[model samples]
Target: MFTQFVQQFGVTTCGTMVWGWHGRTLSSGVHHPQYGDCWLRLLAAPKAKAGGKLWDGPRLAAERFDGRVHKAQMYASVPHVLDDFAYLAELSRAITEPVCSEEPVLREEPALPDRWWASLQTDLDTVAHGTSDRVAVRQEWINRVVPQFLNVEPPQIRHWAVAHGDLHPANLTAGTPYLLDWEGFGLAPVGYDQALLTAYSCLVPGFVKKVRDIFPVLQNEDGRAALLVVIADLLQSASRGDHPELAPALHELARTAI
Candidate 1:
């Protein structure tokens, strides 16, 4: 079905995922006929019934803060009811730059541009009060996840803002630094995104420090509380056998945060 769809646009499939119904890559001819160098990505759309926000976050970022997000070309619907949607978007390639590592890293830093940080802050501000189609962050979810793993009580949240809920090194590109994967973007605690990045970089002291230096919110009370929320979420994911290699590092971070 996807192959036939690509054929309609006269674009060839350059790559496909080995497993999962998540992704496909198409030749750049779909976007440009002459200097067709850009790649197109076919990504799995989030399910509405599953509390997916459908492209609300990315669309807002693209329209309001252009450079912060990759642009989308179109979307298609599948016949099936459950797994029924996909979106085609322009895939960004770093210009002589390093892509973010998918695996957890303890060292090896990538240079992130100052403009990218500015874009992130601007993006967060633009979407801070925007309506979300995904599940809103709740104190109950935090309560359920936190106390089960940590002895400390969940921290009170005094500030709220829209966040790239899955913010981490993997979801971010270095150098130019465009944030990817908006399926989980929604209203979260103000510092939640930075907290997740910090947790992911916890294995690298220098990188963690870099994150702290970039986002000074992590040094405050609300930021510390938000980091606990991220740690709680990570612990929940770890319990399900995801990122088992980072289990030790996650545990250490959780202890310190708590």
Candidate 2:
């Protein structure tokens, strides 16, 4: 797939391959003859479930949100099949800054200036205002997972808004707070993005406190509900053997929050 696209798109893969969770995605830094440096993510899934809003997320996001808060998307490709599997690719301007943390789930808080925090708040507010019909988090899914994973009475969701959908440490950049991986952005419970970050930062008490302090919504009923929902979702993921190390922390956080 890499060789085929490099030749077809006239791009040279300059960086080592970075595989995403479960090998679902393969990303590499590429240099294009005309476009210069770029980042390419090749997404793969079973052919039966290969294409959807996620396939075009970066392209669509580029149309609505500018590069100030996210990487500027350059191009997207139609599905390319390989027997029972299908593949698609998205290209965006390479972000020169390092990720906010070395990993997706923060093992420890990274050094971030107050100005960066302020910019993150501003950018997240902007993200919530983004319009999209996609449903990133569904009430039905929340209803089912919250009780199952959180073991608490699910809090009612009174508000809904667009969110970055995925805002973990890896998806965020350090210096100025650019959100990556727009594939999950859409309408979710209010403060979904904020709560998601908080859940992921559960192991870091200082970072969790700071995030809760910065986002007042975390103190409200709706935002609290959002936090539980995100916790439930992550716990579900952990149950499936994805980051099981987070299971204990997430469960502890859910207990305290509830």
Candidate 3:
């Protein structure tokens, strides 16, 4: 059944004959003696297309097969981020809790409501010292704006469903747009996805307005400030890599942070 579908949708991928190992969302190139190996991540369509072709959609980390560490982290983290946001959005609507408010939508989670903002602070602290100083600065900015603009007092965030800790286009894929990578996913901060998306909008135009319309709570400065925090976080993330394609945007985000 899978092979038939691949025949139809999978793009013709060319590389030296190498071993293939499949995982949840990625396939690794078997280490080979010659013609350095590469990875081919298959993105099968939800439904098969013409001629029962299986679309071997895109290959992630094609050039370098050595850094299994970074590749695995990204693969897991990206989907986890998407799932968290999607889950939180659904829970917020089901309970009719203002998606934009920093309050718990699921009152049943009592312990959660009490420590929402505190949890955020802890995460911020982790990033400040662990990720980069810029991340810490951005988190500080977010803390200031929350009380002043969003009117969120001592407990600015409400207990809610888990959130996709980090969300951005690079971490996501349209074929499997909603994969689950749980490492950074957690609960805290309202409109977190919108903030991340808005920050990404600076790189891809029209993204900001589109995300804002879908997430109405992001219309003001408070929401935008929250978005800046995520953007700063992403900048720190991008800086850790040597991918030239990511450097320019990271540099731009750094400038925007100031």
Candidate 4:
């Protein structure tokens, strides 16, 4: 199926998904004369599990944010034998360099424009209030993850907004600074994205300081609460043996925040 799909796009060679989690992705130099390069993602539609919805975030972002987001050029869907569905979305290749390398452990900060930050805040607000149906980031979810992973009670949330739920260095591009991976994008605690980026930058002291200096949210109470939530989420991922190297750092960070 994968090979056939590539053929439809006339792509001769396609690399494996650079970061495959909830879906599969591939990067390829397009064979078509009209297009140069592209990225493709195949995602499984939401199931009948706890949080099920038909909203396609990447598609929505492509439409709403347009030039600011990685462009979604084309997409198609296929029905599964069961009561589920799958989709293939092709996006325009990012022209700018990513803020950090694919493995963000040793990445250095990239120069970004002030306008990028301004646009990010505006876009996040638009998405959070945009007409879409998805699960809101409830206090219960944070409460559950915090105690289970960080072994501490959850903090109170003072604000909420639409966030790029998986905000980290790896998912951001510099120069122009376009955010990637909208699969997890949704309404979340205010400053959640900033907190997540700070958590991931714990290894790089300079970068951490830069992030803190740029985003004033890090100094406020609500921002601190959001950081605690991000730490708990990271700790939970660490417990599953994901990003083991960052576990200790995340633990210490969580301690300081708590």
Q: Which tens-of-lDDT digit does each residue in 1-258 have in candidate 3? A: 223222333323333332222322333232222322323333322232311111211112111211221122222101112221210000000011122212111111112232333443343333222221111123445465434422333223332223344444444322212222222444435556556645654544444445566565556544544554555455554556423344355346434333
Ranking by TM-score: 2, 4, 1, 3
> How many residue pairs clash per model?
0, 0, 20, 0
Which ten contiguous residues of candidate 2 have the minimum total lDDT?
Answer: 67-76
User: Which candidate do you rate higher for TM-score, 1 or 2?
Assistant: 2
Q: What lDDT, from 0 to 1, does candidate 4 have?
A: 0.65
TM-score of each: 0.73, 0.91, 0.35, 0.77
lDDT of candidates 1 onward, in order: 0.61, 0.83, 0.34, 0.65
For residues 30-106, what per-residue lDDT tens digits would candidate 1 score against the true structure? 33343343344444444443223544444444444344343232232222223554443433331223447665443
Off by over 4 Å in 4: 7-19, 44-55, 68-87, 91-99, 104-131
- Give the TM-score (vs. native) of candidate 3: 0.35
Q: What is the lDDT of candidate 1?
A: 0.61
Span of ten consecutive residues with least summed lDDT in model 3: 86-95
- The better candidate by TM-score, 2 or 4, is 2
Candidate 2 lDDT over 9-118, as tens digits, reads 77888999999877888989999877789988888889999767777676667777865465555664655899998888777778878897887788888888998889
Q: Root-mean-square deviation of each candidate, in angstroms?
A: 4.6, 2.0, 18.5, 4.0
Cα lDDT tens digits for candidate 4, 184-234: 666778788888988887887777777788778778887888889988887
TM-score of 4: 0.77
Q: Choose 3 or 4, whichever is better by TM-score.
A: 4
C-alpha root-mean-square deviation, candidate 1: 4.6
